[model samples]
Target: MERPNNVPLPGVSAARAAERATSLAAHLDARHRGQNAQALIRAAVKDLFRGRIALVSSFGADSAVLLHLVAQVDPTTPVIFVDTGQLFEETLQYRDQLVALLGLTDVRSVGPKTDRLARLDPENFLWQSNPDLCCRIRKVEPLAEAIGDFPAWISGRKRFQNAFRAELPVFEGDGARIKVNPLAEWTGKDVEAYRLEHGLPEHPLVKFGYLSIGCAPCTDRVKPGEDPRAGRWRGRAKTECGIHIAGSMTPENEGSGI
Candidate 1:
């Protein structure tokens, strides 16, 4: 009884695939602690380097760790920084310094489309009523469009930084591309150690307790032991501004002129 190669065997069911995905996710999450972070990222780089892989950086308080790693692997790899027209002056300056010191090449600054920004909110006043919309316009939408051609992108997200990121994996599938978090399992201390060891520069705001730096208007400084992202969109019932996700936005939430 010869069996066809492509078809499943007599009793193979869809459940097996679901189980495999779950198992694989769990295994990677569990195994991604400490030294495994670099090992897995190196492996991923090798596997994914057949095409373009951009490192999405904010040059924020904690991004130096991953940026240093990326520089070590391939300085020529594209590093995409979204300059949302509202970042701290220090942040922008830090970005330039780090890029120069790390010898990073292809560091492109992606921003909102010019005409859309003019049509949506000519004065950039949309941050008042619809912060989410402002974010989509200035950050998410532009970034999604910019990265449309790449199959995978690198990020500096760590699990300990936010509740929504508690279960972050080294690799996850975005709607259009894969998101690789090489530092997913790292903690604040780990980042500090890497920075110090490699002589990487930190964002100037970090010393002033701005743990999670985003747009200037939506972000603020935090006290010790507070959630790093506590000050972002402060007094508003928002955790993330949806800049990282693709197409999960609505006109009401992401386009309303608030």
Candidate 2:
């Protein structure tokens, strides 16, 4: 087999990626168990950087914490942002502000293949009826395409986000990619403290009770003491839009509606 980095990288087959992802998951799991969660994440990131890995960001409400961590380690790591065309204006603004303040060197915004959307749902009503299919078209497929050439990518999914994420491992294999959720063990308070201490730019909607901000149409504000993610896809049977793994996001008997 060709050396990992020397092969023709872009558009690697799903099968090949799965193989590497499994190996990466094993190595990370073994090495990180004895270390504290934050230390483990930082160590994993440093290993990726030494091997020239790509770091992905959504630049959402919780994204600042991860971005801040990446900036401390390596400012030049390629940071890919998936612009689903449905994000709030505040998210876009925050993305720019954080990149500049953190001195991120290679930030790129990616979107879905143009014709795919036109063919799938010309009226854009797919989100209203079948949000999973809509998100697959808009977010997942494009992201799968964007990260095809990378061995690893980072995410900010904290375990406290929902029941689906409560037992999240420090490292895991997500089909064709090594999905690294660094802050997997962090609570809500941890995120707030990081932002305050670092003096990071906040997403404008955060103050309006919008905790888990996603596409504009699918998000809303939550009431006090409510689940931060309770506002998304309000009144609909959708906890997550299938961006995260299916089993990892299955809603409880409480029904899927946000």
Candidate 3:
């Protein structure tokens, strides 16, 4: 029998959940396609997802633009930050500064389980041998847990940031949840203008040529006329840390060394 659109499916399988999420994402993308970044964020945070959504931020370079928009909408909105335990000290301090300046009330910092780290990466050199696995334990897993209760989440990705994200949509499905990229259509000029207009502080590393900041070990300084994200995972084919990709989020017990 065909289920009605308004009817709820109880105990649906993972496949079914993903299908539903995809459908929801399409609808949302179409509905809010013409809205500006601020308007779109307001809708996602206040109207559409409301209490069931969160914003996952790296608190990296150019993060303040999106964070400022979200703050204007609701300073108390849940913001999930994954502390990979390998980030630059400047990044940590920048996170704190932004939270206080924006008056954000619910900023949660999550990291890998101590037991898992001790067993799988006691030497903390997993990033050297297996960057993907290191990200799985430090970023992907922790973020998955942080946003598990939410049906939707916001990302700070912008199309102008990198070629991989150049065609990013304002709304998309990630596993069983809807991922919103309010600034997907925004350009680099847009971000800089907004930041300066609002007097948003820049990440300290940006001045040192670290345009695309990540962990201290993996990130490097971008040379003149290079891609902003060229500094990430330098000399390696790896671009992302595995958090933004689909199917990267695994079950909590899948790789937990416990």
Candidate 4:
């Protein structure tokens, strides 16, 4: 099973994409077990995943923390933003403002194919009747197609964001990619402190009690003392956009990679 140094590793190649996602996820989890978000970002962008890594951001409330960290580590790193075509105007504007301020060179805006939308959701009210399907076409599918080529990708999810996210790990495999969550341990206070300390721009909607901004139709303003993500998919059983959930990130079976 041992290969010589002259022989190139199969799964590590760019063409192979995420063939080594499981192994790399385990290694990164072990290597950066006790590191902070900044440290994890450095390893992901400059060392471990390097050219094969990307950071996905929603430009939602507290997103500035992870974006700022990734920008500092490597502004040229591919920043994948899933534009579900249902995003709020404020979120769109915030994405632009933050990218300009951060001087990120490779911020890519990806969305569902127009024809796909035309065929599946011409009425545009699918979110009301079938949120899961709407999310699949508008958010999950688009995001998967965007990040699928990368061996690894970073997410801004944190444990304190909601009940389901309370057990999130810093590193885990999502079938096709090693999904890194550098801010998994970050609290709301930690996010705010990082934003203020680094002078990062906040999402415009954050001040309006929209603590967890998402699509315009699904998101609502959060009440005081409620979870930051409580307003998302308000009055619905769905807590996630289906992108992360559909990926089936089983940190439990993987034994908590981080």
Specify the highest-TM-score model's number.
3
Query: Weakest 10 consecutive residues, lDDT, candidate 1?
Result: 1-10
Q: For all the candidates, what are their Cα RMSDs to the real structure?
A: 6.7, 6.0, 3.5, 6.1
Clashing pairs in 2: 236-257
Q: For model 1, how does the per-residue alpha-carbon lDDT over 1-258 read when each residue is reduced to its tens digit?
A: 121111113464434432443454444445544546566666546553334578888899998888888777778878888899988999999998998888997898988878878987798888887787788788887676666556567888889887878977776645434567788888888889988988888789988889999999999889777788988888988888685553342222333333
What is each predicted model's overall lDDT from 0 to 1? 0.72, 0.73, 0.85, 0.78
Order of quality (TM-score): 3, 4, 2, 1
Error of 4 at 147 (Å): 1.4
Candidate 3 Cα outliers beyond 4 Å, as residue runs: 1-10, 250-258
Per-model TM values vs. the true structure: 0.82, 0.84, 0.93, 0.87
Model 1 misplaced stretches (Cα beyond 4 Å)? 1-35, 246-258
Please give the lDDT score at residue 184 for candidate 2.
83
- In the range 1-258, model 2's lDDT, one tens digit per residue, is 122232224676545655666676777777667675456556655654345466777787788888888788778777888888888999999999999999998897888777877877688787887887777777776666666556566777888987778888777766555667778888999999988999987888898888999999999998888777888889987887565663222112011222
Query: The CA-based lDDT of model 3 is what?
Result: 0.85
Task: Write down the worst ten-residue block by lDDT for model 2.
Answer: 249-258
- lDDT by residue for model 3 (1-258), tens: 221131125667666766777788898899788899999998888888777788999999989999999999999999999899999999999999999999999999999989879978999999899988888888887887887758788998988788899889999877677889999998878898999999999999999999888889999999998888999999999989887787554333334432
Clash number by candidate, in order: 2, 1, 0, 0
| TM-score head-to-head 2 vs 4, winner | 4
